[model samples]
Every structure is written in C-alpha cells, then in structure tokens.
Target: MAEVRTVAIVEDDPIIGASLAQRFAIEGITTQWWRSGEEALAGFARHRPQVVVCDIRLPDLDGESLFGRSTRLLGPVPFLFITAFGDIEQAVRLVRAGA
Candidate 1:
C-alpha cells in the first residue's frame, strides 16, 4: 500500500500548530506546518500534502478561500478545518460546501 506521506497544518496559533504537529509526529505522519495561507500556497506549489488541517481564521486569507485556492493548485485533497466556537456556523457552511 502507498504510505500517507505528509499532513499540512495551517494555523496562526503557534501553540496549536506545534501541538498538532507533535501529535501527528507521534503517529509517524510527516507534517508541514504553515503559519499563514500565503505560506501554505507557496508550499503547495512544491509539494501537496496528503492531508491539510487548516484554521478558519487565518491571517492572510480565510479557510474557505484557502481551501479553494489549494484545490486549484493540487486538486481535491482531504481537508480538515478548525475554527472558534463562535464561527461554528461558518465552519458548517464550509463543510457543507465540501471544504
């Protein structure tokens, strides 16, 4: 079977990003952490992660926008989005729209 090569974490919160990275590492998943949407885009140009975990409230671009752009670059990869409790509605909408 083919291995799951990389998991990308796109979060502005340093703590969250580090914590998630550590957890994925423990599971033996190669991870790439991008602090912003722009950084993720640049990285995607080089290598598309097998999975992308992104924060909805990104600094440069929102999660939905990032998801759209990322899909354009690398095609439909699995994406998991995180957001604050207050933004649950938006998150739901995005998910329903296939984020």
Candidate 2:
C-alpha cells in the first residue's frame, strides 16, 4: 500500500466526523468527510480516496452496504468500520469481507 495522502470519512455524528477530519488534517492528511452514505457515495463517484473510515450505522446505508456498493468504484481501497453498538457478528463479517 502506498502512503495515504487522503481519507474519506463517512460518519453521521458531527462531533466524531469533525474530530477525525481534524486529526487527519493535523497529520497533514487531506480528508473528505461525508455525513451520510448517499453523500459519500456521490463523492466517491467523483474521486476515490486511499482509505475510508465509515460508521456502521449510517443515515441511509449501513457500513456493509456502503462497502458493498462502493467496492467497484473504489477498487482496492481499505475500509475501517466504526460503531458504538459493538456488534461482534457484523465485525466478523466485515473482517471476512476484507474491510
């Protein structure tokens, strides 16, 4: 994997999204933070990033759904899923799917 210069953040929570973007910015990484799956999907169609940090439960599509739908457009980009619910089954599924 090459050095990641940019990351796309898909998170509904304003605080978490802003914080992640801020931290990435501090490290001199460019970030495209989207508040919903629809918005992220649209942005992704325009430009795919090196990595994606997405919330498990989004406003429209869930993380898994978004991953499934974006795989073709995003290619082999890495995905990191976040969730407060701590669903082990979903985590296993995601890991198995190469998230």
- Structural similarity to truth (TM-score) of each candidate: 0.89, 0.96
**Please, what is the whole-model Cα lDDT of each candidate in the order they appear?**
0.90, 0.92
In TM-score terms, candidate 1 sits at 0.89
Q: After superposition, how far is residue 58 of candidate 1 from its true place, in Å?
A: 1.0
Residue ranges of candidate 2 with Cα displaced over 4 Å: none
- Local accuracy of candidate 1 as per-residue lDDT tens digits, 1-99: 568779999999999999999999999999999999999999999987988999988899988999999988998888998877427677678778677
Point to the candidate with the largest lDDT.
2
Among these predicted structures, which one has the highest TM-score? 2
- Give lDDT for model 2: 0.92
- Tell me how many clashing residue pairs each candidate has: 0, 0
